[model samples]
Target: MKILITGGAGFLGLHLAKYFSEHFVGNKDFCSLLDIAEFDKKEYPKNCHFIKADIRNSTLMYQYIKSMDYVIHAAAALPLWKEKDIFDINVGGTKNILEASFKNKVKRVIYVSSTAVYGVPKKHPIYENDRRVGVGSYGQSKIEAENLCFSYIKKGLNVTIIRPKTFLGTHRLGVFEILFDWIHDGKKIPVVGSGNNRYQLLDVDDLVEAIYLFVVRSGHPQGVQRQQGHPKGDLIYNGAFNIGAEKFTTVKKDLEKVFIYASSERSESRSHNKNSSRQARTISKVFPTPAFFVKKALWLFEKLKLSPLYQWVYDTADKDSFVSVKRLTETLN
Candidate 1:
């Protein structure tokens, strides 16, 4: 089938493009991507096509989408940004996708929505059936995008919505990139208070598997019709999965481990102060490191009007954040 992925230069988009190119070889149907970035032809798949364009360009995107069999809409704004950018793109752009798909008569359009669509998880296992409410503009925008899908479904667009948790693996690398980069850079990892907050993160590979299932399922090609008793040609999924070393991790304790692992590679920790078990003992688990703590402390200092220490702390803590991923198992499966 001819497939097109939007925001194809982003991490998840790149992975999806690779997956489709390598796995779908029948008739060697086009596996193309649309985004504003240029593809490195020398390094990227030769057979796969890449079209540079903004998702909001309705006229261009609408005309371009006409020849495809399916679309994987992975474009959107994260919850960490200003609200207006989020609305202008995710909401408006989604409406445009639906319009283009409808006009072109594309087979299936898989929307890679976010757990942000649900704001914070109220229940341990948030199912596809749970209510969607958001805290900030990020979540609010996601909610709007999801509603857009349903709106298209009402108009007879074949749509499927997947709400994913803190998924990681490639380009985007989750939020954990900060921690990894910190440890690698010989900096102390910061931890929040005791670092006990947990979050569910899914592997992008596993998420790709789920997307494959929903998209290829038997359904109408032209999307769900309007005035429906129930959405006739759509699938909704809560994308939660546990792919971390453990289901949960603490900040302070985890950061300590990472720091020990990173610093102990020096062979000097053996001679340095070894009296305090927490101080000298090498951490064995995957989590945040001392730099994570240092980061939080710095953030605190900045908030409290502290001096030089605040700047140092901010530098180290720039990447010190964590989330629990245990709840993912219940939601995705």
Candidate 2:
């Protein structure tokens, strides 16, 4: 069994590569990591092969995807990227990947989509069948890419779309890195609002497990084998499914937990140096700001290119943002 992972240099891509490397240990089972960015070989397992290739290159993608048992499409232009680049990579690149995989007759293709497609929806526990209202170029491109997945599925390609929430784990950088730095320095963490919203987040490990299940397990529901009048071509697993943490509290509580953990670790270290004259630093506090004013300021900063945050983030910070993972759980079970 051979597996190929697109966007192999990204945070999620690295995690997926590490997770799959452990399972594909057979002498014949090889994993290929394809990305436009250069990969650090020391960071990846020895069983993995790195290919410096762009998914937008149709010829290169087609050539690499040949004879692959599985393809995990985790590549996408993030929200911070330029609008044109986002569309080009997320939409255009996705088209190339699907086209290549379809033509090569790959056994399965797992598309790592985002919950951003829901786009600050008015309802809670957004379902798989919910109407997608993209908030920005990134979100809109995801919806368009998902549409391509559906089109290919209709053409008899085995594809599974996994829509995951904002996931964090080891080696995750960007916004979370900034937040961790603030906490480490004992700075006040400013939230957009009261920080009372139940914003769900997924652990990268949990997401990797979900993807592995989708890859190894049969697509059919338990005890429901194909029979007369049944739909064809792994329809159950080929559809879109939401993925998120099953348990999470409000934003304030979650931040407080992290603060508490940081304080405990500091205390443990201070115990070894009892004679030190320096005072112990304080843990960070969550400082809530008015959402209206903060949003206005963020909007101005975005217009001035002073901040990386976009509308989808600050606009939904104070609102309830979560999705129903019941479908995923039941299907995988």
Candidate 3:
């Protein structure tokens, strides 16, 4: 079947492209990658087609989405920008894709939403029906964009919404680079707060598998419906699912793991030298940057356009934000 993926050169999108390419290579009509920027040919499968186009171009969206079996709306303005005028790309672009998909009768659309829509949750293990008070402009735009998907769904579009948290894997390089760099350089790793708050992070490999489950799986098992709202006797599983890992770790412990891994590699590399010490370098203490200080620094960085973490990371760093994946697990099973 033909499939179209927007923002195909992005971190998550790149992983999705590689996953589909390896799984469906040699079928030239299997998949197409659409992005505003050009991609490296050597990085993609031999058969996948690459299209340089913006999703905001309604005509382009129509021309490409036409006659496609599946469309994954993964393009969005991540919160790295100095300004928050992302409605054109985040909300308006989604509207264009959905309108085109509806007109062309696309079979299924995997709309990738984010955990940012939930803002700072007041409770742990946030559910799908939890409050959707967005924190920043990026979050606000995502909420609006998600509403567009549901609007199309009401018009008979089979759209599945996947809300994933801060996913990490090999392709991750933006904010994560800070951690990797500090760890590799044997510098003190900084934690935003007291580091007791637990953060849920899903591996990209696991996230891709979950997306595969949604695409291939059909009908939920009996008595598996766990939605909070819907009329009685209606067993339809709403196509929305919050994707997160079951296990969670404190920010401090997670950074320590990175430190340990980096130290091991350093030790192994230096072992050949007779002057190298036998003991591994361990970081016994962490630099604890207060949340208020981080916020102030982020504000200044945004003004100066010198920071990559920006407002999104600072807004949620000290908060306990995690989703309940029980619904997703049951549906997949």
Candidate 4:
């Protein structure tokens, strides 16, 4: 079984490649990684093929997707990218991938979408059927790309849309990197508001597992079975589902845990050194700020290209932003 992973050099792409490589150990089963950026050959498994090609190039996408058993559409322009680029890459690029996969008759296409499609909702534990109101260009692009997925599904393309929350794991940079740097330097970490909001996060490993379940268990051409209540031809996994960490606490508590862990590690290292003083090192602390002012400042910084924080991030930082994984769990079970 051959697999194609788009955005193969990205954070999630790298994780997915590692996970799939471990499972697909058969002589014939291998992964083809497609990305615009060059891949570090050392980071990927030997059973993988790397192709540096932009997904926006429809011809390249078409040629690359041919004869693939599965296609993981993980490529997209992130929030920090320009608005035009985000739409072009996220929405338009997705159309290209879907078209190629559809034409090639790939068995399944797993689309790595985002919870950002829900935007900053007042409702807690958002469900799959909840209304989607995108917050920014990135969020809006996801919504548009998801619509494309649904359209293709209607045309008999087996697609699974996985809407995961902000996930983190090894080598995860972006906003989390800034937080880690502040914690490392013992600088005060600022929270947009009272750090009491229950902002859930997912481990990338868990997300990869969830995606694998969809790939192997559903939308197969041969063993295609419908759920009890679903439509006649609709397979269980060929739909959108929300996924996130089952266990999480308030933002303040989580950040504090990281700080505590970092402090302990530093203290342990100091204790081992005979020449080092026993004096305690300064530890990082969470500093809460007024959300209104912080949002205004962030907006200004974004306009001036001074900060990486985007509207969707700061707008929902202090809000209750978790989705119901009931659909995902129940369906998988």
Q: State TM-scores per candidate.
A: 0.69, 0.93, 0.88, 0.93
Worst 10 residues of 2 by lDDT: 219-228
Q: lDDT of each model, Cα atoms only?
A: 0.63, 0.87, 0.78, 0.87
For model 2, how does the per-residue alpha-carbon lDDT over 224-260 read when each residue is reduced to its tens digit? Answer: 4432245643557787999999999899999999998
TM accuracy, model 4: 0.93
lDDT string for model 1 (1-333, tens) is 778899887777777877776766654647787887676555556667878888888998888798988888998865444568788888989888889998898877888877555544445445555676765566677788888788777777777776665566865554477766666556554443334544344678877876775555534342233213445224432232223323434445546666776666644644675553433233333334465566665567655755333232234232332333345343233
Which scores higher on TM-score, 1 or 4? 4
Q: What is the overall TM-score of model 2 with all chains considered together?
A: 0.93
Tens digit of per-residue lDDT, candidate 4, span 15-126: 9988988887764537889899888889888888889999899998889999788899999998989899999999999999999999999888999999999988998899
Whole-model alpha-carbon lDDT for candidate 4: 0.87
**Pairs with steric clashes in candidate 2:** none
As a TM-score, model 3 comes out at 0.88
Location of the lowest summed lDDT over 10 successive residues in candidate 3:
218-227
User: Which residue ranges in model 4 land beyond 4 Å of their true spot?
Assistant: 219-234, 274-280
